[model samples]
Target: MDKLRDFLKSWPGRILLILCLSPLALLGIESYFHSGVDPNQIAQVGDASVSLNEYQSAVNNRRSEILENLEDASLLNEDVLHEQVLRGLVDRALLEQQAKKLGMTVSDDTINRLLREEAIFKDENGNFSNDLFATFLRQRGMTKDQLFAEFRNQLSLDQLNASIVGTAIYPMKAINQLIDLQLESRKVWLHRFNWQDYQQQVTVNDADVKAYYEANKKSLKSPAMVDLAYIELTPEMIKVNEVTQQEIDAQYQSFKQELGLSDDRQISQILLTGSDAKARADAIKARLDKGESFAALAKAESDDPSGESGGAIGQFNPAVFGGDAAAVEQALSGLKVNQASKPVKTQFGYQIFMVTSEGSSQVPSLASVRDEMVKRTKAYKQQTLFADKVTAINDLAADGFGIEDIASQENVPLKRIKNYQQDNNTSALSQPAVIKQAFDEFVIQDQSVTTAIDTGKSTVWVQPSRYRPAKTLSLTEATVKITQVLKQQKASALALKAAKDMAAKIKTEADINKQGISFQALGDTNRQSPLLSDKERSLAFSQPAPKNGVAAMASQTEMGATLIVGDAIKTQQQSQLSAIEKAQTAAIIRDNLGQDQLQDYLEYLRVIHKVEVNDANMASAQGR
Candidate 1:
């Protein structure tokens, strides 16, 4: 406990402690500080409240998680996301209250068990990996401390549902009933009506269309829209910078030195010391260059113990050496048997090297590494270019430059999108935030260009030509839509009316054939039966089991209406939901019931606490 408390005082431990306690401890902590609700609070549940600041932080984090997982960020629905985050905070608030009331908090052992279950924290063999922990932190741009904090934070959030999971119980009878309902199979006879059959009979004039338009015109209003232009920037869009031969050659030289590539076999070294060592070694090399004997020079004036034996060293087998073996080997690499190399520096001071015998080089040829060198060079250059271009675009936008000018300078095409609206995109620029960011940054601002909107893999800047807030569109603008809707409604009414008329006259399954109704027989279909559409299957199972007669019902669909007739219903037992099988299924059902209980508990808490959510403030939070 002392160790744990001391660790908690460390930066990362403190962060983790904060993560575990935050907004939650804040749930009711503020009540002790102030009596009235804070103006920034987005929701209030009992004495607990969700502040706008906390909600915004969650939104940003959720958005980042979503964007990271998405291939295309444009598909994100901001409104749905906004509501999702808000509801989560609200539910979390309720859970926090219940957990505190029940004195339910996760224990250290429980946390450890839960952490082991999380795959991210474990390696393939299922043990906690410190390297993987560091990697996960790096990927999320977090420090070790923050990740530590996050781990505890995750446990705290999970613990919020302690009351729900612990208290929720599924009655044996209820579980059995669920199994019966879920496992029940029905024999269905499906009659699909062709829309064309009813279309020809139903006629719609201008007056009929006008009446339908007035009733549903609110939905017919044109979406909040913007006519805009934007430039999308992705790393792939940047041209790869060139790699010069000089650079490749330099890298090759480095590779050769590092690998100690050499053709020299039987080698010799003359070790020396002092600042004048290079001068002396150069003088000896000059004498050797003038055809003097290298062994004779080594014998007369070398510091190495091998000097008495003419400084001979064995072939490059990593044996004893006068100085650095790799350095000596590299120096001896270029030397012929009778020749001496220029002085090479070593920790022993300076040394001269010579090869006494010939052998094949251990070093690979230039051609062997040229392709790799080129690829590495190009990749590095491309990355730098991408970063530079993105920075330049951001700077230009900051400097109040128009998007067109910035696009032209960057040499990317400026694409235009007309009447772009939320959840309705016609062009390739689909990231749901494009319009939102555009409206938020460029719409109200006097500026023409939006700030750089980064989606991790890509960035974009939008310039709106016109902005149209959501409003009721004129009759002329919505006439075509209204006409299509009226036509569909009139046709559906006709189909249902005809199907009902036919049903009233039919008395049994035999009468169906007399009425010229042809139904395809679907045998032994369950709730998840692929043979029937969802509506068709629902109608099939919802009707009571026919004791002696047929049960029939009509429902409208896009293809027209379906006339479902049921003559049999059977429970799947012995073969499917056997006694043992039902027990196993009951376990899963119980878990689901637990989740349902959690939702119901949250709902109950909301009602009792007089929970209130400020939508206007929610919108403001979303805008941020």
Candidate 2:
């Protein structure tokens, strides 16, 4: 008894014992002590005993799967583990209950067949590999029977879920309609109103300013603030000296060799113009065949902007031409001297080529490139060193060292900022992590304790010198600001009303026609209309057109007139639904309206099952 008491005092020992005993209590004391226990004895449909061993196994399996898929071992967190396990247990229970309700059953034959064909259990010849199957089970620390049982149970539960959710499908007409909507394009003329144009005319009175200030006093209240000291390490400041001329020459020679420019081309061009251009081009090709000067012909006949300067196209890599330059490359592939290419027709027009000379593509030695590398390497090393230094400083602060001591030791200047908030308003702090750490340290019971935190680019040590509680605004201070907001809202309402009145004045299509404006019918403009601005698009679809009058508004730019659809368009769309869509749409409407019915059904199941959770076990699992 004394030993048991001592064990219970220890956190880990207490947690393990509690978890192990809870399942036994739920399954009954006798069954808990027995060997070769029946898994079903832990739970029935309604109230089930969730075994600690089973839950742990499930968590391990899930964790392993996540690690494999993410290829990252460091992603594991206790909170995530707890949440996933709890969710899995709850979902498993729900599925089991659903399976029982549907009378779904799994037999040994079904389990065997599924296992044999599961791909994981199959050999190269497509035959069931019993050894592979056994190995996989062994890896998971499960016996063959245990694995089979779990597989069978899961299959039954899956069938039950499928029956409830049903298959998702879209009819041909719906698919076609979706496709058309995606592909359809819209043409629109847009006019914009500049706010700057109206800003000059808007005047602020003394009363207006006072009212605005009063109403917005709460918004202007100072937020919770923090002050922090940080150190930043960056690579760009690192300096490298003493690069030799020999090194520079070596690098230049290496770069030159790598360029391999000796075999590159410098060619001239000419473009034949006008409607009979093809015929003129053929004639030019014939002259080129007769060995006329290619450069002279390009200068005389080519309409290219580069026709001057003897049509010099300059040097180029032959590999970049792809198949279009295949003949030119082949002809000049082994040419060591200057060569001209036969006329070739390209999509742009006809082209000629020339190979200037041959060159090597060798690169310089590492010794040659070492000077530039040293500068870059120095910067990289400096940045890394700076990060490590900052981390050490943060560690010192976290261990309760003062920021002043750190700054003095590191020989870095430390500045104290006042009236700063740790929240989103702390934009002036420069180092966000420093501010955050300061706020976190300040909130603790120990007022003198300092902490170090990462400020993204640097590490900071924060010491909270003082703490301030939040303050609410006085009513007198808030009044002026409120009045300004109210006034602006009133102005907006009036503007909207004026726009609507203008829209009403244009009653018919005749009004638009009489105004000399052409009406372009937009047939079933769905979500993809490019002509509509975001706000206009949303309003157009949602509000539609009114029946009696035009819904006109000044364009967003305040430069032109605009109209929203009136009642006739809305009526037409409603009447245009096909029979099948109409039926499906009605069913959707019914389902949305009858969501309460589904909730009631789930509630009825809960009552019949009498579900219970072992709160002690859950708490133990959560390390609470």
Candidate 3:
């Protein structure tokens, strides 16, 4: 118990815990209505389960991101997104389980140094700020122990991934050949057959337009759409209640009390567990009294993983150690630096602690964390209000009331959307979750409000109004479009024939000039050149070296067609590559190979772990 508190309070304990709280990658979201370890699991992979809140959170996250960039959120089908997000979570669970089975761990020294280096926990003077760290965790509803677990698990997962990727074959001979291809360049020339030059000469009559429209009528159908009515609850729509000065003062006092900020102690321990723990602890105390080194004794005698690190448990506090903390604190109260405590009974076993170090009182004045206190106070109030509102809305929903009636009762605005298509991702209320629910067969047939659907910042209730099936347009409506399409096709065909004829006549660059054909002198370029299209780059560099002067080949392009003439095929020696270039090229190859290897390993793990997806839960998603 003492050892874990010591570990948790140390800078390294929750390294990834804070980072996993990526604005993108959620780590225990404060979605009280959804994010708790609820029974609403979407998928079960072995013993690990992914909750519905997790899936909702992922959807909301993705939807909001698309909305932020002014892109259509409806572009992705919510059902598909649901599958993708759930699959990812399940895969993560599998990797973590596998890593645990293999007994993988992040070394204490490595994690600790990383945490201490984290800028979020650092003070103005660059020292680890326990106050700031605690505040951050409090906001996120996380305890230090949770942070430790998160960091350990995340690191272990990364380690497993890296180890598998490391197993990728080098295949240096093939790699060198690929590298040679990448470094190869070519001097080329293009012979053009412009579509515009042929379009003016080709005439299309009314009969042609009618025939083309008749054949392509199915492709010109109008979009299918649905009408919707909904009431949404976004964070901005909810107001935060005020926190009083008295509340701030009370919170300040509580922080100091809970953290034991008066005097912070750092300790190391030698633990003796099992039946004869007390007796063994006494024996070690006697050896310590004889002037043997505490660290050396702990390393040789302790029954804990920390034993490898000379039993250095790091910063100690009561919040982490819990009930056993009372005895440990009392034992440490009388001990000075380098002084050892007598055998103390803890949850783990009997531990003899030595005060390795101590820090000055961490007690902060109300003025010193004032801004953070106000922020924390308001956030707490806001969450309470949000949860209350959600509950109230939920109750209103269950009483057989529609979205309009509920909105009126709750004083939230009701909204109606017209022509809501599955692909209409750009509308104000076009959240993928909402769109998905609006289009659901159950909701469409039932014509009743669905349960609460959580978006990134909002909770939604949707009811379908009407459905509009797709219809084919009349020939008159499709004539203009059909004519344009038919014209481009004929023009392109003519251009390709012209280009092929040009290529057949001109075997060399000099012959191209002799034929009075216009072309672009595309200078030396490699496989990855920005000046050439992907196809153009491959065509330019891949042609056989000219038997006489240059080689010409014809191919179709977007605009028309092109006769490609390769003048010279150039190669750069691998020895001439700069150190950075070589490193970059090697990184590309390794990254590609590593990803494939990692994916193969993950597939193997999936089979071994036996993943079972709850399709009903993933599909229904009837929110709490």
Question: Which candidate gets the maximum lDDT versus the true structure?
Answer: 3
- For 290-372, candidate 2 gives per-residue lDDT tens digits of 87876787778877776665566665554445554444434344433345555566555666544444435323334555566
TM-score head-to-head 1 vs 2, winner: 1
Window of ten residues with lowest summed lDDT in model 3: 26-35
lDDT of each: 0.69, 0.51, 0.73
Model 1, 64: alpha-carbon shift in Å? 4.5
TM-score quality measure for candidate 3: 0.52
- lDDT per residue (tens digit) for residues 1-624 in model 1: 553465467544444554533322322111111235577888887887878777777667667767678876766878887777777777766765566675655455654565445555666687887787676557757765544344444445456654456566777688788777777886666777766677777777778767877887788777777778889887777777578865665566666667787444777777777888878887887887898777788888688788888889766653454435555555654455667777888777677778787767656545666798787667666777877887888889888888889989989899888877755655566566676776674354554777777664688888876777778867778788777776777788788777767767655778767877577877667888877788877877777745777777788877778887777777867655667877777777776777888778777888877788887887677665
Q: Estimate each model's TM-score.
A: 0.65, 0.47, 0.52
Candidate 1 regions with alpha-carbon error over 4 angstroms: 1-61, 77-163, 186-191, 245-373, 441-447, 454-458, 497-524, 544-553, 564-567, 577-584, 603-623
Once superposed on the true structure, which residue ranges of model 3 sit more than 4 Å away at CA? 1-19, 23-38, 58-81, 106-144, 170-184, 194-466, 470-494, 526-531, 571-576, 620-624
TM-score ranking, high to low:
1, 3, 2
